[model samples]
Target: MDSYKLLINLPDTIVFLSPNLKVVDATDEYLKATMKTREELIGQDFLTTFPDNPSELLSHNMMIVRDSLMRVIATKDTDLLATLRYDIPKPESQGGGFEERYWEAVHKPVVDENGNLKYIIQRTSDVTQNVLAKRAAELEENKYRFMMNALPQLIYTTDNTGRATFFNQKWYDYTGTNPDILATNSWQSSIHPEDLPKVIEKVGHSLRNGTEFQMELRVRNGKGIYRWFLTRSIPMRDENNNILMWVGSSVDVHNTREMVFELEQSHEQMVELSEQVQQAYGKAEAERKVLHNLIMKAPVFFCVLRGPEHRYELMNERYQKLFPNRNLIGQSVAEALPEVAEQGFVKVLDEVYETGREFVAEKIKVTLDRYGNGKLEEMTLTFMYQTIYDENSKVTGIMVCGFDVGEQISS
Candidate 1:
């Protein structure tokens, strides 16, 4: 029987180790994974051939591996190491430095029928990508937590079971309660007694139906005064459209509610005054006022560019941050962002104009002068350019809407 032939055909990266921890044989996958040839590895001591990289955080990674191998040999039991950060050194021709890596490894002992240790089978899987992705997610979650805490409004998150998972610092500040108490659902104790049952019933119905949960209820503040708040929750879903958790916010609306009630009570007196004001100003002015307010206050970055040259016609407050000092209202993209023309974004605009087609781009990479310095830096943005048509149904301009999603792209 050809023992080596069987080991060589395995798809996983595997290495056969003698009792003394020498590399007796390895699979082709092992050779390709390690960028090594059979002659360089076959007779070498396993630890010496793949030593712990000096750049690694833990100096004893190799030592820990050796200990695991020894334990398997002594007990004749398989040992699994879930994950370890172990960098690998590149060959001299490849610049000779260690590259960061992660591995899921196992040491399986091969015992003879007489219960004597014959060899150790070491198998390893590269899991660097998974580790990095998990780390990035953690960092992003932490960033969001910080942002939530900074806001004045109370914010909270709950798991699928409707149990509290997280509450921002603002929640504690407003409720005068700590996480330990909130963890036990004590935050609900701050709700107005008369409104509690109604709020809970509404929330229960939303949770059961997987719909948006919203309620206007009076909440007791830190000073023990009940004030009106509009608490709302939305489901956060995964890529598969399955609800993962609930993110909710509690916004104080006590003053606004009081003002609205006062206005309603004085409607008879305001009716005459409102009619006089309407007579003074045409109906078109009122409509324009409403439209202007919507554009100025909308959360998204909104803009419009007219003509084939793509001269900017309008930009909202949020869009103005793209280039703080430079006014883009009448400048073409090429004139306002000369650095972008070289990055091929100007060509993208031209294509959209020529075809009169809406262009949607996500994570589009461009080099721009982020700090007003002549030196350009790369940035990623997700944006859309929709053609605006004239009365004759001809393309006249492009409407733009987008925001900076660089953090998401990098993650």
Candidate 2:
């Protein structure tokens, strides 16, 4: 067999260059891949024949290729270049533009008996698809991280063995701890002593059984004040339903729990004093007023929506301030806040109302025409919809309570 014919017919995209970096020859596969014929490539300078894409202002393809070739010459050994974006120009008949491409290349030097470099052999493979796929995956991961960090709740991830692996910024901010704490039991030390045992037992059981873990525990904040947090963790599974990891969130519910306790106490006192109609009625009314005042003065926004259409029955001062120009009371949510409905809040409301289940969402994005000028503005909220019941235990309305966390997240 002819040696030159054998080299040209080889199935790999290979090119041979002289010691002076002049193209000596290339395989047929190389000619086809580069959209050039042997007549156009042979005898031409290797760098001149395949120049960097001029349209790309920050292109470093020529520099990288030259450095790899120089390294091979210096070491007299093979040099590998991975994931290089070396675009190729199209022929004028093909509309005359550069086509974006990625490649993996190997540059090997052939030496003579005297150890002098004779020829440089280049082998390259197109890796455009793999490079693009990796970039897309990285972009998706970045988006996921952005969403996690935007949440008001503390977000974390753990291995199947219940060992913590990752925690978002909110976790560090709330705990006033650094990444070093994850390696030790320092995070657990922040949990109240009374709640630590239960948390450990529940987490261990969940890890053993691959079940969801949930608990309301008191966690000490940056100021060393213990506050109640509703913590929940769910197992992330693989295709075969095997546990891979755990994703968890801890939402601070201290104020809501305190308010509920106060309401329950007031309800019990009203029931006990019911026999004395005049005295009971006055005392119950006074208690109701005090509770109303407390709700009004709370830091979070609060509202009550009645009926299936979600007509705004009442809104606290904070809630009303969210849409100062709109008349929310006596108006359906869809009528008063069309933008909210457009963003699918009404569907979420319907689901909660129909199921009679509380829906809690943290860092939910809500767009509103705040000034009634038809200009939409986006805001982030950490909120909940709790089912309200009538005297006979029939679901009547929904109580909406939330904090506008836009400023907090931005800062």
Candidate 3:
């Protein structure tokens, strides 16, 4: 580890000067580079290697080399690395030539036991590729930030604990909150109270299951209006499926909810109004039919009774027409009509006399031998029965009406 031996035999020896500024040992590599042998250069001075002219490299005044070597010696105990640029005289093949060599050297001060300064150690490294790569990464980071801030949808990221760590500018603009609010309960405050429980349930389930998350809920805007937000979150995980982080997006659905509510309101109003109008028309039609039957007939086709024992009562032309050849005054209908018992008409009349509800039979048809030779004829009779009521709304007797409808039935 002798300095003289290392300096003379080192293959990359550009030059190695002693502390006394003397050429005590010219490196073998230096001698070999100069097209000279060691025997002729071992004890020679620095002036013997090059021309001893005043302006040449070995001259009386080498200002650049002297100043550089002086600075390296003085700064040996201070800065660890040093840089120096120098012009190396190239081979004078056809003309005088020069080249610039930039050297970045690491310098360390060597010391002796007597606390005397010794020769310094230096090492050089090239950094052409490293500097270029570092610059490229800086440019990429700026580009990414620009794109994120310009996004319309809110972009957000959270840790595995469901705590927010990062969100884009769009999220802040929509929510009117800063990054300081992210670690707090600011995000939960934005969600509507009604939708909070479902979002929590699903998010908790996905977190425990180590799966992606998705949810839809109403979120309060800056103006304090609740709007629908469709959130989709994807779990970021390690290779073993352990949760690392989550990424999600929020999209606005305010217009969609408003439109749906409007349609539902319109449908409900239509249903209620239709039912009201239908009931009103049905009642009016029923009343018109009752009034028309009373006033439209001259010699009425109906009659009523009023006193005890169902005595002989008033009759109509239609009734007298049925028994045309007989004087039908003061004659009971049950006695005159022999088929009344078989037709069940008296039973219905008795029920009406007790209940006082108007009871009517639509129609009944009988085939009678009308001709003398026993030829058959068909007749249809419609009877309406009602229990007559007095001034006190008490039942007095029954009213019955009959109509022949055999021809109307065929039509």
Per-model tally of clashing residue pairs:
0, 0, 0
Candidate 3 on 42-76: residue-level lDDT in tens? 44543334432333353233344444456767765
Q: Residue by residue across 23-142, what tens digits does model 1's lDDT show?
A: 999999988888788898988998988888765566349878888998998789999987988777678988987778888999999988998999999999988899999999999999
Best by TM-score: 2
Identify the runs in model 1 with alpha carbons over 4 angstroms from their true place. 1-3, 72-78, 111-116, 159-164, 180-183, 204-215, 235-245, 255-411
What's the lDDT for candidate 2?
Answer: 0.86
Q: Which ten residues in a row have the lowest lDDT in candidate 2?
A: 269-278
Could you tell me which residue pairs clash in candidate 3?
none
Q: For residues 1-411, what per-residue lDDT tens digits would candidate 2 score against the true structure?
A: 699889899999999999889999999999988998999998999998888888885454898999999998899999999877988878888998888888999999999999999999999998888988999999999999899999777999998888888889898898888888778846897899999999999999999899878789999988999999988898999999999999998878887898778766765665465546536568767666656766776667999999889999988888988988678799988888888889898998998788565678878788889988999998889889878889976778999998899866666
TM-score of each: 0.58, 0.72, 0.42
Model 2 misses residue 273 by how many Å?
A: 3.3
Off by over 4 Å in 3: 1-106, 112-116, 123-138, 183-186, 223-225, 237-243, 270-411
Superior by TM-score: candidate 1 or candidate 3: 1
Shift in Å, residue 68, candidate 3: 12
Which of candidates 2 and 3 reaches a greater TM-score?
A: 2
